[model samples]
Target: MLLPQALKKGDTIGIITPSSPAPVLFKARYERGLSQLERMGFKIKEGKCSKQTQSYRSASIQERSEEINDFIHDQEVRGIISTIGGMNSNSLLPYLDYAHLKKHPKVIMGYSDVTALLLGIYAKTGLTTFYGPAVVPSFGEYPEMLPKGKEYFEDVIQLRKKAPYVLDVPQEWTEEMLDWNTQDRQKQMVKNTGWKSLREGSATGKLIGGNLNTMSGFMSSAFFPDLEGVILFLEDSFKDIATQERSLSMLKISGVFDKIAGLIIGKHEHFNHLNAPFSIEDLLFEIMGETNIPILTNVDIGHTFPSHVFPIGIKVKLDANQGTIEFLENSVSE
Candidate 1:
């Protein structure tokens, strides 16, 4: 696997709007995210799609791909991050300069709908991509980026913390929804209940996965990574039990459950049980049947506050019984 170079203090981080027109729609919060990066001692270069908008997305499909390709061709840009995630990132896959990215590997990070790109890039070029925070939703939190979230980002991207270490379960977290435009206070955080071990076992394998709903968009395409011995991690936001069943069933029918060595489920933000008699866990087990594997859930990842940065293609050990994840290799080269 190819590991991008660790970011340095003065590195230039290019920002792209792969899907959402977040920079245009949420100008103040967008600027705040950029400011956070600048304050962290990095230079920010806004991509072409940064200011463009086409109602739901930042730009047309071709324009969005062009924005990413431009960044890929720029030697000055050490990393690329999305302003936010939306619905059509998959449209840019066929047009991306994956070969160029393979040769000039750099850190590409984002979560939610950006999962399409993260998994696609990794699958096509064998270069690690991050399933982590995005600009408007994460780094641009009111007042400032959540301290723990910032720490986790730095730990992986900047190599401030090395591998062979277990990720910390945050002491507190929040899925509180506030009006991003009119919000004037920090989110209300609750005490973390910590990760839950659904199945007892341990497995070490390559790390891979992102937003579950987004995976369905391109799962049948060649861009999707092979799950053969991966410790897959999945998360979603604002989804109900019914949707969760369908998403899980997609994996089951595809033989995904049989291929993975372990599973790490991120905390689902605003999950609606819909008055169901059974929880998602019960549904998962029902679909899984006798296919036993190590399973851990409710860990800090995805849309939740203070989420951990997961590097796709890195080797990781998941101890489900203990509810711990330990990275076996550095996510980036020094």
Candidate 2:
């Protein structure tokens, strides 16, 4: 797998609005996010779509794709991060300058709807992409980015720490929501109950996956990465039991369960059980139909605060019996 150069203190990070017009909709929070990045000692270059808005999305598909392509050709930009995630990032896939990105690789990171881009880029170029925090919901949080989330980002992208290490579960986490425009303080956090080992086993394979619902947009396309022997991680937010069934069934029907080595499920933000008598775990087992792969759930990753930064295509060891996840190698090069 291709690794991007490790980001340094003074490197420029290009910010693009591939889908949502968040910078315009939440101007105050958006500026705060940029301020936080500046405080981290990184230069910020706002792409054309950063300030543009056409109702739901920042711009048209052509404009959105061009914004990313512009950053791909920019020599000074060492990384690109989404301002926020929305529904149509999949629309930008076909128009991206994948060949240019493959030749001049850089760190590309975001979560939620941006999963389409992360997995798509990794599939197209074999360059590792990040499934982590985005500007608005994460970095733009009232006072600043959550400390653990910041550390994970720096550790992976900025190379503050090396890999071949186990990931730490934050002692506390939050899924509380506050209106961004009128928020005054931090969201209320609760003690982490810890990861659950749904199955007792272990496996090591390449790590690949992101927001479970977002995968539906491109799962059938060439953009989706191969699942063969991969330790797949999936997470979603505000989804009901029915939605969960459909999404899980998509993978089941696609032969994903047969191909993957292990599964890591991140903490679902504001999940709606739909008053089902069965839990999501029970539903998952029903859909999986007796696959014996190791499965770990309630791990901290995705929409929740202080989430871990997962580098797509990196080698990882998943020990479901012990509820541990370890990165087997560094995700970025010096």
Candidate 3:
């Protein structure tokens, strides 16, 4: 895998709205996110799409692709982070300049609907992309970004922390939502239950996966990578059990379960069971059938506060029996 150079103090981090026009939609929060990055000692460059909103998305596919490619070609931009995730990032895939990105390797990171971009870039270029915070919902968090969220970002991108480390179970987390435009307080966090082991055992493999719903957009395309021996981690927000069953069944039919070395199910944010007779885990087991890959669920990642960043192509050791994940190697180069 092509590891991007680690972000350093004063390095410019370019921000783009490949999906949502969060800057226009939530001006105050968006600017706060930029200010937070500035306070962290990095320069910021706003992509053209940041200011352009078309109802649900930032701009046309052509425009969004151009915005991201602009950062890719800019020699001074050390990293690229999404403003927010929306529903249409996959539309920009064919238009993305993968060759240019390959030649100019750098950090490209985000989650939610932007999973299309993160995993797409990794699949095309063998460049490790981050599945972590987007500016508005994460860094722009009111009062200040959550310390744990900021620390996780610093751990991976800035090397503020290092690898050969086991991820800490955050003592608290939140999925509480407020109107982004009128919000003024930090999210209310509750005691975290931490990770749970669904099946007991251990396995190690390159880490891959993001929002399960987002994968449907680009799955099996040239943008989706081979999942053989992958430690697949996925999560979602507001999805009901029926939808989850269909998605999981999609993966099952595609033989993803047979290929993966293990599975990590992240804590679902505001999940609805829809009055189903079975729990989400029961649904998962129904779809998984008899596959015996070590299964770990309720991990503190994706759509939840105090989330951890996962690099797309990094070797990871997942001991599901112990409910732990350890990065075996640093995901970025200096």
Candidate 4:
């Protein structure tokens, strides 16, 4: 995977609404995010379609695709960030000029629906992208950026270091809102409980995988990555245990589990098994039994607050037994 240059303090960060129009529904928070970037010594560039809203998409597919292409082609923009995630980002894939993106790669970060873009971009150009918080979720809310979000964001873009990094749980986690209009809200702190190991073992490979639903959607697509030698990280929100099992079963059928070197299960929020009468643990163990690769569950990296930001297309060594991940190489350009 190509490591884009690490962002400097004064570098320009382009903000685009590739899926949903965040500025339309969260105008105040969007502005707050922009202000936060400025305060952090980074220049912010808004995409032309950032505020445009359509029936189910943030903007017309053409417009959103163009905005992303333009940002990637802009020499002054050191990195790119999506405002938020939404359904239908896949529609913009055909319009994306992968050849152009390959010529001028940069840091592209977002999560949830943005998973499509992250994996698509990686498959097309071999560029490392981040699956983490967005502007609204990370920067624009009542309180300032979530501490873990901010720390991981800085670690990936500014620290320019490799991982094998130990995951720390936050002392506190919050789903409540602070007063966004109040200046002091930015200083309010949230705590976390740190990362916990579900299965104990050590394994390493290229880190791949994202929202299970999103990855499932791309199963037959040309953009799906070569799963061999990959440590698959999977997570989702609002999905029942049955659905989760179905998705994992699909992966198993497609030889995804068989191809990967390891598996990392991130936090699955709001997941409940239906009347199917089976526990999530039972489903996971059943599906994972197909592969002998080291499997780690609940690594604290998805659909939850205070998640870690790691390169999706880079090599990673996961020691579930030790509760740690080590990177064999740096994730950014020097």
Question: What is the number of backbone collisions in each predicted candidate, taken in the order shown?
Answer: 0, 0, 0, 14
Per-residue lDDT tens digits of candidate 1, residues 1-334? 9999999899999999999899998899999999999999999999999988888988899989999999999999999999899898999999999999999999999999999999999999999999888889988999999999999999999999998999999999999999889999999999999999999999999999999999999997999999999999999999999999999999999999999999999999999999999989999999998988999999999999999999999999999988899999999999
Candidate 2 lDDT tens digits, 1-334 = 9999998989999999999899999999999999999999999999999889999899999999999999999999999999999899999999999999999999999999999999999999999999988898888997889899899999899888898899998999999989999999989989999999999899999999999999988997999999999999999999888999999999999999999999999999999998999999999999999899999999999988889999999999999988999999888999
| Candidate 1 local lDDT, residue 178 | 92
Work out how many backbone clashes candidate 3 has.
0
Alpha-carbon deviation at 136 in model 4, angstroms:
1.1
Q: How far is candidate 2 from the true structure (C-alpha RMSD, Å)?
A: 0.7
lDDT of each: 0.95, 0.94, 0.92, 0.78
TM-score of each: 0.99, 0.99, 0.99, 0.91
Candidate 3 vs. true structure, TM-score? 0.99
Cα deviation at 58, candidate 4, in Å, is 1.0
Span of 10 residues, lowest total lDDT, candidate 2: 155-164
lDDT tens per residue, model 3, 292-313:
9888999988899989998999
lDDT against true structure, model 1: 0.95
lDDT score at residue 205, model 4, on the 0-100 scale: 85
